[model samples]
Target: MEKKHMLQIEGLTKAYGNKIVLDNLNLTVEQGDIYGFLGPNGSGKTTTIRAVLGLVNYQKGNVILNGFDIKKDFKKSIQKVGAVVETPRFFENYSGYWNLKVMADFYDHVPRKRIDEVLEIVGMEKRAKEKVKTYSLGMKQRLGIARALIHSPELVILDEPTNGLDPQGMKEVREMIIQLSIEQNITFFVSTHLLSEVEVLCNKVCILKRGQKIEEGVVKKLLNKDYEVLDIYTPSVKKAMDCLIRDNRVISINPFSEGFKIEVQQGYADKIVKILVEDNVPVRYVIPRNQSLEDYFIEQTKGGEHIA
Candidate 1:
């Protein structure tokens, strides 16, 4: 039997001053799944989060959490959700443990050990006693996560979780989020503009353009192996591309720092080499180009008509 869904949004619509931010949006996130939501600026990523969390009232559709309607019982609908929409507000002078304790007290019946467990889950148990002022930005972000998890929420929503971190900090948070999904069976729904971050962390994603979903699917299939990039560099770009300029298979050869960038038809490496050698153009290197989530994201959002 399939597990019960953690979140369900059907035909969700929200507008601001006659500006339609979300139009008949629909989505579902199951437990143990990390859904990456990507879109450009002003694409309603924040609006979607607000609607799901009940911070903003909407005119149409339903936002349900574990079958409980958000409109009818706000308490029940939010019980399983823990989200960090922006930077978490915390008392700077207090230690991490103290801050968590203060928040946990608001929700009666929270266990004593829950605070420590959440700190440990985010790898902050050792530093829990340290003053919040001394914590790094990454540490603060993790604390926000710990605070979110203090209630044992089934779904954790993070927006730009790694916004200003250095490389190591980004990796730290990324690994922690992934570990949570694997070890504790936590479900993550993250909204981010960083393509590589989403690609590395999320298994599925829903892309929005001007508040409308343009593509949604498993990351692996959405990127389709068939779209892999092929990088062809030649020492003599002008000479090498002379034979294939007018050919139907070759798109365009661009001059680059190392050599010339040759965009060829998909899976046409064999033909590219054969033509190059036949025309006496010295082929220096041919390798698969590493593509980030940004490439696919740009292709999906701005590749065609803009929808508002």
Candidate 2:
């Protein structure tokens, strides 16, 4: 069976006056994908989201949602989409059930039973009648998700869904997202600054930097690409460094407090060990450094913090 594309952005470019915010960015989300949209501040993550939702104007490219062109068919394109770009607003004094009831009023197809169904899906059924003010931040977040899902949207866009959450709260939201993706077959387009969350939750990721996509791939494959980083501990740090520096396979080496961090082409760790040992250098231990999503992000962004 041919896979269906839930969302597609081709050559998407956005600008504020003369400054470019999104530069020829392209991305695609397939059905049932938990796709991570990641970037430092001002990398155009928000801009791209806004463009897709038609909240902002883009200078170039096109956004297609569920085979409908957003620009040419705004209403139909957005019908299958729901989003919580930031904190969701609600009538603080109103019960959760009432809040969703009010929201369901905006659409003719959403039924009263749908509200109860969504509440159960988000694990908020027990507290569905409680006032919004009494809900914890996590509970409120779950409510926001329930609201987003009330229409049974095929794709949901969430920006920092777990922001400001405690560890338990974050875990709850994370597990909820995973469960929804598995059980409902809904596609998720999530933007988050939390690299650890993306590492565990997203099946694929797209990294943006300065309005450009610098990296995009499956999470595991990207992290396991053909590069080996090793932390070598030895008394003769200087000798080991010199020996490895001479090898053409070694990419770069930096000294740490106890040892040196070395980067080399994959499958060359054994060669590095053999070279150091043959040079009469004291061999303590060579530990394989696990490359993390954060490490990869830092490398691509060049240690740049949120820009603007």
lDDT of 2 at 7: 93
Q: What are the RMSD figures for all models against the true structure?
A: 3.7, 2.7
Query: How do the residues 1-308 of candidate 1 rate in per-residue lDDT, one tens digit apiece?
Result: 78678888899889888999999888888878899887776788888998889889998999888789989998988887788886666799999999999988867688989998999888899999999999988888989999988888889989778877889888989998999899888999998877777789999888887888878888887776443345667777778767878887776677776666666677775687788888888878887665556666766665533321
lDDT, candidate 2, at 85: 75
| Candidate 2 weakest ten by summed lDDT | 299-308
Report every candidate's CA lDDT: 0.82, 0.88
User: In model 2, what are the clashing residue pairs, if there are any?
Assistant: none
Compared to the true structure, candidate 1 yields what TM-score? 0.84
Model 1: lDDT of residue 231: 66
